[model samples]
Target: MLPNQSFVWTGATPGVRYRFAILADAGNFLPDQCSTRWGSTDFGSRGLPGSPGFSGVPTRNNANGINVSWNDYNASYGVQHWRLYRSASAANRCSDTHIATLPRSTRSFLDSSAAFNTDYYYTFIASDLNGVNGPCSSNSAAGFRPGQAPTVSAISVSPATVVAAGTTVNLGVSATGAIPSNTVAYQWRAAGQVVGGSSPSYSFVGQGNHGTKQYDVLVSHPESAFSVTRSQNITVCRADQIVSNNACVCPGTLQEIGGQCACPPPLVRVDNQCLAPTPTPTATPLPNSFPQIINQPQSQSVQEGQSVTFGVVAAGNPVPNYQWFRDNLNPVGGNDPQYSFVAALSDNGARFKVRVSNSVGSVDSNEVILTVQSAPRPLRPVLECVMANNDGTLTAFFGYENQNIAAVTIPAGTNSGGDANLVNGGSILPGTQQPIDFSPGRVRGAFGVVFSAQGSAAYTLGYRGTGIVTETANSQSTPCAPIEPRLACVNPEGAGFRARFTYSNQNAFNVIIPSGPNNRFSPAPEYRDQPINFLAALGQSDHFEVVSSSGGDLTWILANLSATASGNSTPCSLPPVCNAGGPYRVQQGQNQVTLNASGSFDPEGLPLIYAWSTTCPGASIAGTLSPLATLNLVGNRQTCAVNLA
Candidate 1:
């Protein structure tokens, strides 16, 4: 007994409760064989009715008899066999009777075939393969009923809500209170209008009307009327519309007023509020005079280093002060009527604004953009070999200019010079490629190129031409005359000094003594800083050196000179030899010589004298000299041009 078990002595649906017990001494108080009645009748105090039970207390179809069927109570329990019996007492006191016993699941057990209108009581026992006997469990009182009807529950629609032009919708119907083993048919209706039958769900492919469309479903069993209809509705066009919901468009002359059109100006309306006419352009009480903004430089674009000027003409109660701004914020230079800027690339897209201020007010003119661009760089010249020289050499030149010219190299077959090798850092001619000398015998004659420079560097491309050679003339050099030496510059005693030496004289002439920046000179050497000057002095037995005014401090070595043309009897006409009437003289005429000894000062400040002599015995002369010495010379005609002694 799972707790709360109650036993009732039931007969023909009478309500009562009872428990069977043995007599005090009968079978040792065992309850196996005795029966009793209990319930609202309080049968526990009355005990069992009689030792022998009454025969057929109630019969089937009689007012006191009751019939049982699972289908009448909407039960799904199937029966394979059943047994019926009757007695004058309760469950423990009844005599068992064998009724119809059949196999397999069954739903209907008819008691109508026997005893009509008579009180023939019946007890039903149903069992399946599992031996589950019917009335295995019953209510406190017997339950009876007519067959149930199929009841439909709430209906449902897939995509429950849709637009006015309703798309396909699936309808479904379900029922809970329905007869078991009975087929239920469904009928669908729209807005009380019969639409279709025999389906649990239906689809409405389109919206039936603009308003809410309602669908109802009715479920029915073959033996009963349809219980009830379940319904659901879907409303179409649920969106709010301007025309239907307080909205209007403004006409050309009228304005929208609370969703209605109305006249504006003169009866001016703003923000949905109407007002009196706006005063007719009341002579704006502006200052008597307005500051005039003048145009400086209106519109122009310039490269870096270019100047830009801006100004404005203004008329106002007070002459306005002008201040310029760049990019609408940064203050640029100004307070005057004009402003200028040296344009730079960073200044590109710069906007210039002028703020004009006076007692009345200040106003800024519309911004003007200053466009800055970069200057166009020079192009590298194209150099090509127009023709080859008689020596089968390709001589060309190019005028690529810059602050300085760095390394120059001609590549591979383009400049193998017939030895299949490259030559670098040679002379370059104007407006032509560098000369590449080659003998007329080798093959693989295409020219390749690769080069770099200091700034905005670039290289030249090589092109091949006719493989044949033609006799051509090489460039000729013009004999340059010796140039006269002008005192180029003077330095005020610095360790490392520089002076630009100029030679305006066209003919090349050798300095007979140490003159400027003179390095080592022994065997009468010569140094020329420039090509034209160096080539002009070629093969001349001459030496040039820079001598310090300080004794023994000249930057030269007399013994280091190895001139091949020494002792060739060339006159040293630029120096002391000429002034003393020695063997070196141009015209054998008197000339003055000055010696600057400023750099060779003595701390003792000793008295120094100028002594002049020549190879000629009678040419001696002497005089007290300043720290710097000067001398006058006299000519000697005899004794091998009168040697000075």
Candidate 2:
């Protein structure tokens, strides 16, 4: 039994406290499987019945039934099923029973059967198949035995100024009453005539009604004598005045649209007057020159998993090619404004500076030191059953975010929900669509999307609101999540050290490494930080980053002390040697002489590339430095040439 009304033990919605799962015979075992213990949101509550709606005001609708309201946040996502709890008396409020079972998306209820002078309390919870019972808050509303009529605070109008013909203005009324807001009706009057509007606001267009008009709004209730009236007046032009707009005839130039004056093409409005358009300036090409650094790199301290971006503003003759140096030594690649990546511990103390080079000489930027703090230990990836949002493909879905509470948690085990599987560190590319199914509910739906090619990539969660649901938006899942953005950050160290990041000036969010470096270090080795893919390096340069472009500077702090490297490089070996020829004999040539020079050797047995040259001017040699060579003599006496080193 719930606090309000007894929850009928029905077949479809049977469990008081239920257990649900989606584990298969294969993917995940029971021990590792995740299951959620869910709760519900509170329904509407009525305070003491005899109390007046407003403290000092008497409600004329004391005979009317009570009106109850609650938030419909779950319906916006995927959760639509709702259970309403009602208590007959204040004493029973904490022990209300589930009195009503509402379908998905139901938001409000009216209890005309509620007895007058009886204080009733209401609470509610929403759920789909895969989801657990929503949060059930115990809040305490009351229908009055109608007393005095409702009160009219004020009725007013915007723009009391005189209006041109056919101009629309707004009329608004404020009211307070014991009568439920939903039961109130509004009647707007214009010049003592009735208009067709039931809302608190009315749009009244003035079409020159003899220079002046009167308007009033009446607030009324159905079950009570509660009522109020207020009135206001406005001046309207008898007719719209014609304005001249010829460019040659008018001062400057003007055009008219919908009884308003506008400057024509080639003319623009300046202050209250129209004037000739200002000429736009064309940009001139900048001359090429050597690289000069404008904005230098700055030092940072940050938690691991966060990304950092090292940027530089430079001027150069040719667009400069950027080379980022680590420890003022190793080279990272780029020519753009920034470099970004996840931060690793190895990046700590790793100094970063950029050297921009073009046709002109290169200039190095100031080195920024990196400090990495230990990342907060990561909570296990959590999956949960949730009401579907319009961005999903199915009616029901298991959530994929990292929330730990019953409202947002994951299922334990190899529970497959449509397109969602238990893949570690899964990837969703830009523009790629994935399928999601709410488990237990097993509702199938999909959201096919092409992610944007630019900007950092991320996965975000929605707390609750008018999100997508399977029943309402069964097949049409919106690919867009609300712009609750995530960060892309990194540590300067290669990896292994945990890192985290969040904007200091904004609401805090979970720290995430959206991606590795946008571009890696050049002679910089590939970086791996996860435990298994580790590799030991002697003297290598690499890049790790934390995103700084998203409005904040990245700071990496040294939270834990790890080992630092000392000696690097192997001992030098013997250099290779080369000999010209081994016992070469040249034949006395009739027209030419052939020399045998096949034997050239190196002490280190290194493969040698051969080059041959001669100081003799008249004699010609064929295939110089070849195993065999033929020399032709132009003169009777010529010097023989044979050289190799």
Candidate 3:
């Protein structure tokens, strides 16, 4: 504060008066033809000049956070610093404390320190090199909120019904809008007692002695106080019957296992009974005949490093013994049901034949050819998902699923020597399944991975960051939230004012109102011309905050703040309080000043008029009873007295 520092003189001090006289004579007395006239004039239209804006359109617009960017204010007025302010409502322009104090060197901020489902208002203030604080750039930016809690749904159980007593069942759950802090717990209940716990599935034995037992699987989401239960009954099988197959048998007719009657070893059993033995084939003598091939071996097409098999089926009176031949001539191994070999490149186009010999005669079957193809290379890895972190970064998860003649599964990337080739800008090394975190800012890059058995793949990626500021007013005094990077509004101040903070950046700023249902500041935080509105409300008290979106210092002038009543058109149970031009902190200027009542609103939303009175010399109110009026200043040294009813 240098003496007579003009740069620091943003406006005149309130309630302080100054007089300057341009007299005809430097040493004239009041009786002579020399005089000095002075009066106060309030001048300047509503709204600060020039709109602030984000540098680009927002890429990430979720409630978590919003990224902001803008050009510096005009430098002509010796502007040297800019400050950012936020509140739940936009009404506290005169008293709102800024959350950040940034030098002219940069005009960007990543407002990641936001709470879920909370709306915030962000505005910037510029100051001259001498530390004179300027007015709002525009109104504070409209309210924006952080991401919300997870919504869990789609719960289910596998193998829904029970067949055996000791069967293991699996319980699964899926959720949407999930956050990183969510946890899940599984509990299995039986006989109204905790029988088993933990994990996604529960396994228990059915007790026949207890007859049918009803078991319960409980899935819990304790964070949101939400839980789901699924119930199933397991019946105990009697010794003479099996529930799995509904089988009933007489004593000594079958084996018994786990209180259920069933077949013996090496026999397929169903419904408490053993499968009947296959009827012994009856052999009949027949006349001698040449062996015939009823079913011929088919040609084989196999890739390199793979194996192929061929077989022939024949009908003969005396049955048949078979011998397989390769290339239609060379004899191969044992006489079995089929001939098999691990195919090599040299085996391509090779033909094979089978010879059948019966007690009556023998015959040679037609040759079958073998074709070889090239083996497939490793498939490329694919990016599975990405999540935005509060610290201005992204986490990318990658994996690979191969699609071939047969459904094949491939690993995310090649682990040739411990390191993977995917470049996701994460801290995790390649070949690891854990997601990688991308740093704050725009996400745009390509990542690749080479699979040893599957082909290689490269992917382009992108993600946006969210930045913002805001506050909420309780009908009463309540401490601010996001306790880390905030100055919360308490019950006393701006409790019911319609406050909105609006701003623009080089890209794109927050939407005054988000497009969907959830991104709302639901505790009734209001916005008007961008600054948060703090109308006088029932049981209201005085409140103030000293915090930042990330960093800044603010000096709150508590005495200058006053809340006026304004609400909807609905009738008010209490008397309506008159609002005079929404409050004030005007600087002295050469031209007259205009008062704007645009900031005022009825608590019951009643339309309002204004009334003005002034006693400044050579000054008059443009309209004595109007929301908008002017106080004309006739002299350079006078103060206009203003009072409203």
Q: Over the stretch 1-645, how does candidate 1's per-residue lDDT look in tens digits?
A: 323467554441211223454322345665544344344434331122211111222223222224433222113333345444533234531244444554434433444333222233344444533444445222112222234465566777676444434456788877655543246777888888888878887876654344467777777765344456777875554222112222223424455545445655568755445568766665755455556675543656897789988777776776778888888888888697678878878887888878888877787887788888765332222221122222222222222222112222335335222222222332332222333432222212122121222111112322222121211112331222333332222232233222222233222332121222222232222323321222123222122323223222122222112111122212122222123322344345545544433233111222223433335434432442433444445564444332222
Residue 238 CA error for candidate 3 (Å)?
6.7
Each model's lDDT comes to 0.41, 0.46, 0.48
Could you estimate the TM-score for every candidate? 0.20, 0.25, 0.25
Task: Name the better of 1 and 2 by TM-score.
Answer: 2
Please state the error at residue 38 of candidate 3 in Å.
33
lDDT of 1 at 473: 18
> What is the lDDT, from 0 to 100, of the residue 49 in candidate 3?
41
Reference-based lDDT, residue 502, model 1: 26
Across residues 191-281, which tens digit of lDDT does each residue of candidate 3 receive?
6788876765566554445456677767665544556776766554543544444333334456766565567666766654577667679
- Give candidate 3 misplaced runs (Cα > 4 Å): 1-61, 66-71, 75-81, 94-99, 103-110, 127-132, 136-138, 146-170, 174-177, 180-645
Window of ten residues with lowest summed lDDT in model 1: 448-457
* Local lDDT at 326 for model 3: 83
Q: Candidate 3: how large is its RMSD?
A: 53.7
TM-score of 3: 0.25
